[model samples]
Target: MGSVELPGPPRAARPPRPARAPRPRRTIRRRALPYLLIAPTVLALAAVLGYPLVDLVVLSFQDMTRRELFSGATPPWAGLAHYRSILSDGFFWTVVGRTALFTVACVAATMVLSLLVALLMRRVSPWVRTVMTGVLVAVWAMPVMVAASIFRWLSDADYGVVNWLLGLLPGLDFSKHNWFENPWQGFAVITGVVVWGAVPFAALTLQAALSQVPAELEEAALVDGARPGQLFRHVTWPVIKPSAVLVTSLCAIWDFGVFNQIWLMRGGQPEKDYYLLGVYSFIESFAVNRYSAGAAIAVLTVLMLLGGAVVYVRQLVHLGAAE
Candidate 1:
């Protein structure tokens, strides 16, 4: 009887709304599409840069030579022999010393030249500044080899234009000076060439940074009876400090890997006097065809660069913290 009460409209069990399948999860690759566009460039870098560097690291532990340049033939295992030789050899030490000296001289010269140029550019009329900028760009645009060749021709002891110019000076050494005869001479030549090539970029960078410095701040300092030296030391120098650091780090890095200058000029001659770390490794690899030794030297060079980068990064961190 109760059932017959006929579920007068058995409360319609509401059909559950069709449960929508959870939206398909977005894939990480889809999210990364923007960055994936850079894959071609990264792949190219992997081919030209990444593979060679990896090969170098692997080859260091193996006794690879010109005979096995690209062949799959296995190289003999010479665990650390090349590395030990590199570390103990007096020649490598000499290269290290020369490399340090070259970096210091070139960096210092480049900084000084760049800072002076920046100051001069700031003081000059806009047109003159523009002209100087054009000239610097021109010099920087010239290929290193072309510049080196020109300098080489001009560096010839007898017919060298530099020697001739020195003769015109009131007090100077006009005698035949072989630019590549010794380490210091070789370094000086390299330093000069590097500075000439590098100063423009530094100058431009500093000039741009200087332009951003508040003129009112400088004027305020001047009004406070600040001498030019004091103004520079207190106001200009602090404002430009970051730019200076950047320039120094960049020049240091550039000079560290400087191969063409040393290769064209010194070729690691005179008991490996002028041999820099970059040139030394290059000669080890290509010139002498000692892949293992070259790889070891290459590893050392990379370590040096990485060490320098670490120090530079630490400096940047400190600079940032200071700010």
Candidate 2:
């Protein structure tokens, strides 16, 4: 045993293992960084947007007259009184119907015009396309109020270019014709203005979408004896359907709440016969000093728009599933 122990070698020492740095602190910091970065934006939005919205909702539930507003008196709680008054009124329903009609007309016209413009752009030379795009951008950049004012001036019964142009036509005396005197004519004018303003944006969006369509697919369709309409229906349309839907939805939303052009052009005058929801809301809120009623109308308008948005989203989902 003593002789065997003498032949045994000593064990070598093991190296020390490196210690892992703590990860929990770093992980927490990394997670918190994004929230910290976005905190300012969230706070700003709450202050600017959230507060006004909350105030509007609160005001809607209170009977806040102009006198009360000025006298710093607390508005009495009206609960659903405002809503009931607005809903029970026949004029309110009429205004709502008019609003819906106007929105539908404007959206339809805008979509058609935009699609035409987009197709035209696709066929144009580069230089022509650039000039057309510039013109569209200029029109889109024009302020709503300014454009409305210009249209109002142009459609004026006296000293207007529209009347002068119409006078040039034989047996057509539009010099004394009042466009805004009639509800239908006023609606048409307002719809035209809105469509003109909206078409540029929709056209640009559609053009961009069209550009994404595979040229090879279009060429193949053409080679297969597909007519222009067939080629578009089968190839171009499917490719641009999403963008068209989006543009149309946006146009509908904007047209639904169109206030500036309508207000500037008509101002709910002529016995309020041509009144849309926006004009009616303004008249109820400011002109007549029924703030609560106006707020209720505004709320209802928002709900209607929300319903439209939901429908639009569902359509988008269905389209995606089809693909």
Candidate 3:
């Protein structure tokens, strides 16, 4: 019975289960994918902008003379000598004053004209708006060099339409008169060109901001015995204030460093009387071949603009917080 029972039960063997292959380890490329995607842009910026800035800083610290440049000799370290010379010069202070005055005038004029245009845009008929927009776009599309050249030709001492028109005035004798002979007049001309060139952009920005304002608010103000000026002051201004400030800051920055317009109009004429920071920088670098000095002027100009930008950004932050 025991032998029969042992034969009746036979053991069955089970096959072994297959092992799964280990998951592929995350490669270094997988971790750095985002940065890798932006690598080309970052490299291009570094090559174009970053390298030039570094070179400028280095050049500013060295006395890079024309001879050294030609001879391919290493420039000697000036060690802030250029900055000291720039600071000690009385003429530099005068140039700084002129630059400040020019910047202020141009920015003020641009803001005023642009604001007026923007205000007008809101009330104009559709056809008028189309025409106005076309004009603005055309003006904005005009090249800076082209605009400057046109202004130059128009204000020419001889064969200028502007001088011709002025000569028609009975008491005024501007016929073939050198408008650029007087420094103040030259500055005025340059300011006019800058303001004209800037208005289109400023107006467009402001109109866009104005469009965001609720129509009901304006109507409500008008219904409540508010005059046009009062409606703008109470209802419109509060909303557009940030945009206005931003435009002002941008205009100030652009006007402060304006070179082509001033240079093309009057290249540091009348004993450099109308020399702005931009003009001075160009004169020092190319005209006089004082590369380090020019670089110093450029650095200072950047600092000034940075200060303005900081103030503007702070004001915007405050406005946002208040809201």
Best by TM-score: 2
What's every prediction's RMSD, in angstroms? 9.5, 8.6, 11.9
**In order, what lDDT does every prediction score?**
0.83, 0.87, 0.87
Tell me which residue pairs clash in candidate 1.
none
Per model, how many backbone clashes are there? Answer: 0, 0, 0
In model 1, where do residues sit more than 4 Å from their true spots?
1-44, 70-72, 169-175, 266-271, 314-323
Model 3 has how many clashing residue pairs? 0
Write candidate 1's Cα lDDT for 205-297 as tens digits: 999988978899899999999999999998888888887897788789988888887666543342456667877787777777886887898
TM-scores for all predictions:
0.82, 0.84, 0.83
Per-residue error (Å), model 2, residue 241: 0.1
* Whole-model lDDT, model 2: 0.87
- Kindly list the per-residue Cα lDDT of model 3 for residues 1-323, writing each as its tens digit: 35454455666777788898675566655878889899999999998988787788788889999989899999999988988999999999998888899999999999999999998998899899889988999999998888888898889988888999988989989877887788888888888899889999999999999998999999998889899889989999989988899889888888988888877776434257768898888889998899888998888887888888898888779868977
- Residue 129 lDDT, candidate 3, scale 0-100: 82
Give lDDT tens digits, candidate 2, residues 1-323: 35454565878878788898777888899999999999999999999988877888889999998778889999999999888888899989988988898888999999999999999999999999999999999999999888888888888888788989989999988977888778788788888789879989999999999999999999999999999999999999989988898788888888888887876776435348767787788888888888988888988888898888997888788878977
In model 1, how large is the Cα lDDT of residue 284? 78
